[model samples]
Target: MAKLAESNNLVGRVGNAGDTAVGATAGIRLRKSLPWCAAAILGLVGVVYRAILIAVDVPPANSDEGTAGLAALHIGEGRDWPTFFYGQDYMGTFYSYLAAPLVQVFGTHWWTLRLPALVMYAVFLLLVFRLTRTLYSSWFAVFVTAVLAFGSDRVVKDQIIGAGGYSDVATAVAGLMLASALLVLRPEKPRTMLVVWGGLAGYIVWTHWLALPYVAAAVLLVAWVGRAGMTLRRVSLAVCGFLLGAAPLIVFNLRPGRPDSFSVLLSLSGATEPAAWSDRLHGAVLVGLPLSSGLCAPSHCATWQLWWGPTYLVLLVAATAVAVAAFRRADGGGRRVHAGRLALVAGAAMTLAAYVASSSSAMTPVESARYLHYGLVSLPAVLWPLWVGAASVVGKVGSGTSGDHGGIRRRVTGPSLGGAFLAAGCIALAGAFVVGLSVATGQLIAHRSDYAAQADDEQRLVDGLRTAGVSHVYSGYWTCNRLAYRSREQVRCAVLDEDLSPGLDRYRPYRDQVRGSARVAYVLPSSGTMSVNFARSTPALGVDVVSRYELGGYDVYLCRQRPERG
Candidate 1:
């Protein structure tokens, strides 16, 4: 009996010692992780601050940015919620609505409009960290966050002077993060998680109609994963939650005067015909590649040719491999699935869908970096798992014996090989980072002159128009939108092939009413249109060019039209 007690005590002591060692090791790891987390947080803050500085006081460069800024200005002015310059419905009013308070407080300042987007982007980075940490380890989470912090081109564009506050990128990031969280949380408590999943879905739809299908796929994935053992109550809860969250948006969408909203949703869902393959390919290369490259670059149009470098491709391949491995090992059983993996899958799907949907007959093989902004959130998610896998492999190989080897012998033998592999992987990743960064820097430097020239010309044109007693005007291409936003003038029309139709249509009635109304002061012709059309259209209406400026391969024509005095 005494011997038996002694033996049991010995066992207990050994177990306690093991537990103590483990706890100590975990404590050390946690301590080491703290600095990295702090660094990431600080980095995120710096990025946001930088973005605010760059965007503040800068005029909107793109039509989308100009339109969104205008909408926010309208909201600030206490105009109707959805109505902008021409009573046209703005598809993405969520960001505009969020920007309202800021607009109200700041009164149409660039920083005021841009601040909300900056904050949302910061939230997105933090969420990426949290979600990555929850699904993986701190190391992996930090790596993922770092990639996101630097890997997105849109961040630079939106942050930079004149890039305009592209809120859609922020919206897509937030929506993807929310969807990832819901998927990760769903497996633990089906009933509670269903509400989250449904709510996120609705929010995505409201945020950007483009993100809805991705959100839907995420929800369906959760349902499919949990279908077999899920309780009826849990299923019902999910459905109810989804309906509850989606009800408001649905009602708003169905409201009598929301044809634009309805059409946007349909277009995103492939109800509309796919864009031409050439056009899609062109967008993919021109916008997608450059933007992707910019994520690693220091500025815009940097090293335009190498925006999508080999490093991104390598990391993507590695990530895909790790994801496939992890997914294959994941059982339907109780072990909590990693949310990062699920997010990666969902993100890839969303990106693919966006690419396919955005393609048109005019799409070229080279796509635009801008259009692929939807996939920005997904890229890091996909990269995280591969990094984790590489680290794990290193740790394993360094431990010496393949399995069950004597501890001392294994320690001495394992670490060398493991360390080498780990070092190599890190070095490789670093090289890729350098390449991307270099390319981005080059692109930015190359485009600096062009951008500066354009800015100067744009300011001159706006000044001239405002000086000429032109309170409202119609122009086509980039300058029109820029002037409207910067000069706060009502743009009667824009001539562009892109989807500025909504903004342009606002001026149609004015154009038609020209015969009956006062004479117009200014008319701008688009470079995209033939000069013959301008000559025929302008003289017939008694319009003559008063001033012209050329910059960045674009010409701006300022015209004055004879007004009809009553």
Candidate 2:
């Protein structure tokens, strides 16, 4: 009996030894993977820091940003979801939902309202790392994260806006990453993956309806690429998952007073053909290239600006060449896919399609630019592979292996290709970092005076109106949205013919009612067309000019008046 017990103990010891060895191996693998992990952490930190700087310096002052911020503020104020702001039924309940907790904890500070966007952006970076790692190599994952961290002009601008926060960028990026991760990781058991992907897709649609087409295209692409021998059961699961995830948002959208833009597009029956070739080509160059060029310049220009000189052109061409090469060289068929190439193609195709569809009749350059931004997130993928390839060449040269072409080839063959890819990735990432820093510094230096003046003028207007005992104000173009957001007074404004006019129209009927009731205590005119019209048109009501201030090329006028009751 004693001998039998000893034998059992020996067997137990052997099993324990095997388990420890497996665990030790896993630990070693994890340690070796720390570099990629560190990159992700650093990328997140960079996003957070950038968000903080933008929040501190810019404030939530722009009309779009302020509009969203105000809605968020209302939610923070314990208002229920889907509350009306102005006359429009503001259904941006998700952003408000996110802001509610922050407001509860931090009050209605601009930064607090902006925190959701900041958090979403950081989350986006983390998702990028995870998705890229799953689809590609660890090195490529780090490379992708770094590029997104530093390369995107829209991302930087959205971060700076401090209001729209990161709604559009965050939703699109996160949705794509999540969808891609599920597709790559669980290609076989697509039921679970489809549910996750569909939920994210629905959330993205809710966040930015404009991006629905892009999202749909991406979903279709994933379904096609990662088909994994789909059965009827799998197809049914996918369909059900998509419907389940999307139904809630779709129902909400279909309700009375909900936004209907997405529905309108769908009902149009996809009959809208592509735009003219000339228009698409022009957009590809002007919208894609020049807009990106402005990121390298001091001022962020949305159109063809003279600021982008020969150097900008050269860099643009070089980047384009690199992107083309990467796309062409990318292995379309293999066990390991080139996700970067797929993303680039998908993004470019979507952008081109959008341009063709919209620009067929009217040459609205700005609209084209805006629509193209949906696909612009894929730019990093296109550029990343080229940068990685270049870095590999540089590494080979540096290591004196360039002379031994056969040795270099052997080193880059098979699994070692991932390592060579990393060599290139590091260099490209460093370059992107330097460019981002340069652009950021340049913007700060060039715009310092303008931003400071705008800030001072904004504060002055707020203080001046309060001092003058003004309440129930009607703002002209200059103080239209600004005063409405900043002042405690109930503000009104005419629908100005401008970029944000569509949004402003949401309040038009209310403004008309206030005008009819003669409830306005003050009128503030901006030194622009709408303000000038207000000043000239409302003269019979006796304008008592309280103060005038200038900000960013617009003159502001604060006036006290009793509206002539009819």
Candidate 3:
């Protein structure tokens, strides 16, 4: 009986040990997956957020977005393989290419056209989460992700819009940051990684000129971190990678009759109008930063969300100060963390300096804020100090020195002041995010009513044109592409300038088609330059207006013949 009891006890002990090992392994796996799960959830949230914005037309579809959508439509039909935006040589057609398949499959509604931006934003969120986690902790990653999942009104607009390369540039910048971070931490990184970094840099060069600052910062980061291991072979490999990624830009420029995109970019980068350095600096610091940070609305900075603006500025300044202090005393792996943080700071500084010097800074803060969009990629690093300090303070408070009340008191007193400051900064940052989200949500709601009215007007216009059998017409720049795309080519319109002259038509075929029509119509806004020009020009051009219909804000004149300016 004693031997049997011993056997049963040993078996029970073995079973308990096995159960403990299984639980530990499961716990380890869960820990490993938690960050990714958070990332995936946050990414999904970001997509849904942007998708809702796109559906409601928070930005209201403009000519630029229409052009992008048209490009996708053309790509779907194999009408053209464009390397750059139709009228803008500096902005790549990558967004259109990405949207082509979606447009082809789903047709060209705003959602289908803007779906690529959603995917790009998801990628941006994932990369940002990974980058933050790598530099700091998983908790920091979640914080950053949550903040970005619902960005400020301006950030939401930039991310959700399909017009320009804003979303694409943001994603590329995040990728550059992650690649730079990896290289900084692992000096012995394989050559392939260098190639990838170079490729991303090259891609950014073509994606948008606004991203140049990020590309430069990323290159400098890797150069400094891998300076010891960098060799001619590695450099050559990077250059080759750059060439591979930039092949489209290079080939397009090298082709005859193509405008030099580089020159275009240069001209764009130069001053739009001369302004004093002080004014530019004032605009960048006072207006641009707040708009970029989402502390205030664009152009309405001083008036809207006034309280959060100053609070955020103070938090930003405090965080930066703490980061500098931490960097000075950091050691070991902490040194690497600070190095990464410094690189981000340097990038942001360079961006600010560039903005201050550029005439773009003199524009409305909202207009100029687009130039600062990529700087948001550095935000995680900028806010890292606050998070780290708060975490350290919590740890110190929780740590017990049993029977040493004096020691505990001393520990608390020593870090308490700084810890409180850090904690306050963090709390303010969280508040800023909440304020930003509220502003975005509020703006979206406000835009919904306007969007519905605009959409209804557009539909009425389309219906009138179809009912009148108007297959070809002349319209202003803002209406031409939008009308054509929305009508699904049922009523094609050639673009006319404000003066009723030949305007910048993106697709020449549309113009030719309109001009060749035996009878055409004129679609002009009731109060714009195009209306005045048409009313004055048609009489002298000997074009007879047989009939006129007022459709929404537009005047649709059925003309006996196509009007031409002599």
The model with the greatest lDDT is 3
lDDT of 3 at 405: 20
Q: Compared with the true structure, what per-residue lDDT tens digits does model 3 show for residues 468-502?
A: 89999888888888888777788888888887778
Per-residue alpha-carbon lDDT of model 2 for 476-549, expressed as tens digits?
Answer: 44355556555522444544443223224443543554445433443333544655655565555456666666
lDDT of each: 0.52, 0.52, 0.75
1-566: candidate 1 lDDT, tens digit per residue: 99999999999999999999999999988876784677478557547544734453332356555556666666778865652223333243656767777767765445566666666666666665665554444555566565555533344555432222234444454554555454544455445656665665655555455555466556655656555645787767766766765565566666786665656445544426657665554445444545554533333343544434444445566665655665565444212243345555566556654655554313432323444455556655545534543545445422211111122122222336666676577656655654665455445545556655655666676666566555555555444545566665443444332322223433344344332334343333335543435555555646677765543344445665555433
The TM-score of predicted model 3 comes to 0.87
Q: Which rank order by TM-score, best down to worst?
A: 3, 1, 2
Question: Comparing 1 and 3 by lDDT, which wins?
Answer: 3
Top-scoring candidate (TM-score):
3
Tell me which of candidates 1 and 2 scores higher on TM-score: 1
